[model samples]
Target: MFCASVEQMKSIDRRAITQYGIPGVVLMENAGRGVVTVIEKSFAVGRGAEVLVVCGVGNNGGDGMVVCRHLLRRGASPRCFLVGKKSRMKGDAKTNLHILEKCGIDVVEIEDRIPRQFTRSLGRSVLVVDALFGTGFRGKLKGCALEVVERINRSRLPVVSIDCPSGLNVDTGCVDGSCVEATATVTMCVPKVGLVFYPGRRWVGELWVVDIGVPEQAIAEEGMLTSLLESHDIHMPPRDPAGHKTTFGWVAIVAGSSGLTGAGAMASLACLRCGAGMATLCLPESLNAALEAKLTEVMTYPLPETDAKTLSLNALELMAPVLKKADVVAVGPGLSTHPETEQLVRSLIEKVDLPMVVDADGLNALSGKLRILRRRKAATILTPHPGEMARLTKMGVPEIMANKPGVATRFAGENRVTTVLKGAPTIIASPKGEVLINSTGSSALATAGSGDVLTGVIAGLLAQGLSSTDAAATGVFLHGLAGDIMAERRTEYGVIATDLLESIPEAIELVLGSERGFFEGGVRRVL
Candidate 1:
């Protein structure tokens, strides 16, 4: 699903109105009707339902006015509260407000504080429509708007925010102050970046996008590069019916040290579970015996080890034959930060020509040596959490987290490698600056060795002829979906990394079987 920033949405709106000759008021009516559609379908609002419509003196409030008109037509009573001066409303909003006034509806205008009847209004209302702000909203809610949002949140009523939740910064997902916690958000056209990222996502309980008379050409003309990865976007490589073990893919993984041998075992096993035909786990000589016993189906190769029992710099030459025959290579999982091992990782990154999935210490090895990414001829995928990204970019965690898409896009564009910025919602960026926001997983994925499993999944897909971007996006989505399934069966706290390895096939099956997509219906529900 295509997603837009606030400015991009504004441009699309302009193109629809000016270029396509779509009337502004007609778009407002479409938006308001879309909100009603969600309310009727999702909330089951029927006749005689008392709804509260809180609106600001802007185009957003104009939408609320239109909603009031529609609700009245549907035999529901809607009390409209104007949070700003009525004189400030202009354009299509002013026209809608005027139409509501002509219908003998009393629009309560509030400038500063909540009136005495505000509590009584809340007591009688079943649903609250927050049309006080749209995607253009920035900073924090102040004065009466702040109080109104706080009261609406405390009421525990299901809220349907128009366009976006009031007080949300659409550009950054950050909420600086009082923001409405809506039960659902009915966004116009495409989703805003804020609705898909961070704390803002928490405020948006359920997200639904509605077409507000915006033409497809208008949207396509914007040339948006960012997209929300939905179920229908996932495409698995076709399985050959008569294929053998060697026909699928051969993944070579170099991981593990003395005490972290489980990392290598988990990564290699995850590769096979993700449908890789075969896998050979190469670890330090001392750790090979342990992994061989633990991983039954996976093959193991013993590489040269340092004093600390991690893959040593001397192992670089030894991996030549192993890598030469492998379709893809996964490095870093439990490879320790011993100076020799780090050196080995750098050398492999610079010398290896095969597609690579780098994670954990492998990413750590590139902290100050990111220029090596530009020297590689083959595809490279880097999976880094915020802290790891901080180290790789030489930026603070807060800085990277503040603007994940921008940071990931910039890095991928400059380094010419696919970058996966892992977090609550993983962001996958292509070398050409396209960004895909993964919309799966829960806190269940916050377990040890989880990233190792992720590395294996991506490498497994890459070996099967998936592009670096597709492999990262699909891998992150499936990995998160696996985590979600595990969370359902074992609870979020009980799910571990090994549990995810077992759930990969289940996630793939679910995605392949899902029929959900952008159907003919005007509204599309997005999680």
Candidate 2:
């Protein structure tokens, strides 16, 4: 699903109105009707249930007026409260306001201050519809608007916001002050960039995107760069019944050290769990025994080690022949930052022609010289948490976290490699300017060794012949889905990296089986 910024939304709206000849008022009518449909589905509106719709003077208010009309038709009494003066409402909004008055619905106009009666009305109503601001709104909510938002929030009434929450920046997902917390936001056209992001996402609650007659050609012409990753977007090739172990693909995981052997083991294990034909863990010879004991199915390559037990430069020569036989390589989980280890990582990255997924210490190894990533001939995917990304860009973690999509896009475009900026909503950016925001996963994934598992999952997908972009996008989605399953089985607080690994196969099955359902002899089964 495409995610549109405020500008792109505006452009699409304009194109729909002018080029496609779809009237603005028609779009508003469709939006209001769609919202009412959602409302009807969620709550029982007729039989004396009262609804309060608080609206501003813009087109968003027009939508609310239409909602009031629809509610009246359905045997529900809806009271419309205009935050601004009725005279200020113009264009399609004015037309709707006149219609509301013609229909004999109560239209209370509150201009300067919110009347005490408005607060009382909120208490009596079963639901509140917030149409005080649209996607064009920015900055803080002050004066009567502020009081109105706070009063509605304190009332503990369920709110359905139009377009977006009243005070959110539709693009950045930032709120200056006093934003409405809605039970659900009925967004028109495409999902706004802010609704899927944090801070704004919290206020948005459950989001429903309503089609308002916007032409698909109009949206395509806007050339949107960001997309929301869905399960249907992932494409997995059919397995050949005649194929052997090597037919699936081999993944080489170069990771681990003396104390952090678990990282390498978990990564290699995750790779195999995600359907890699074979997984080879190339670690310092000293740590190989421990990993081999833990990982029964994976093969271990004992590489030369330094005094600190991290892989040494001599290990690169040893890895050359192994990498030649592998489809993809996963590096940098728990390989400590010894000078020799960093050198080995740099040399291997520069010399290796195979696709690679670099994470954790591998990212740390390239901290000062991220430019080297640009020189590589093959595809490289960097899976970095905010901290690792900060180091690579020489920016602060706060800055990186604030604008993850922007930062990830810039780095990926510059380095000519796929970048997976891992977080709550992991973002995957391609060198070709496409960005995918992963919608799965939760706080349960905030455990140690989680990222190591993600590195392996992406490597496994890459080994299966997925393009770098598809591999990163699909891997992140599956990793998050597995974490979500683990959270359901075990509470979020108790979930560990191994829980995610164990649920990998189940996650894949869930995605593949999503379309399957029980059917009767000739018709679809109802139960």
- Backbone collision count in every prediction? 0, 0
Using alpha carbons, what is the TM-score of model 1? 0.97
Compared with the true structure, what per-residue lDDT tens digits does model 2 show for residues 217-239? 88889999899887777766557
The C-alpha stretches of model 1 lying farther than 4 A from their native spots are none
Q: Put down candidate 1 lDDT per residue, 375-469, tens digits, no spaces.
A: 99999999999999999998999999889999999999999999999997899999998999998999999999999999999999888889899
Name the runs in model 2 displaced over 4 angstroms.
Answer: 44-46, 515-527
Q: What C-alpha lDDT do the candidate models reach, one value each?
A: 0.91, 0.88
Assess every candidate by TM-score: 0.97, 0.96
lDDT score of model 2?
Answer: 0.88
What CA root-mean-square deviation does each model show from the true structure? 1.4, 3.7
Model 1: pairs clashing at backbone N, Cα or C within 3 Å? none
Model 1 per-residue lDDT at 441: 94
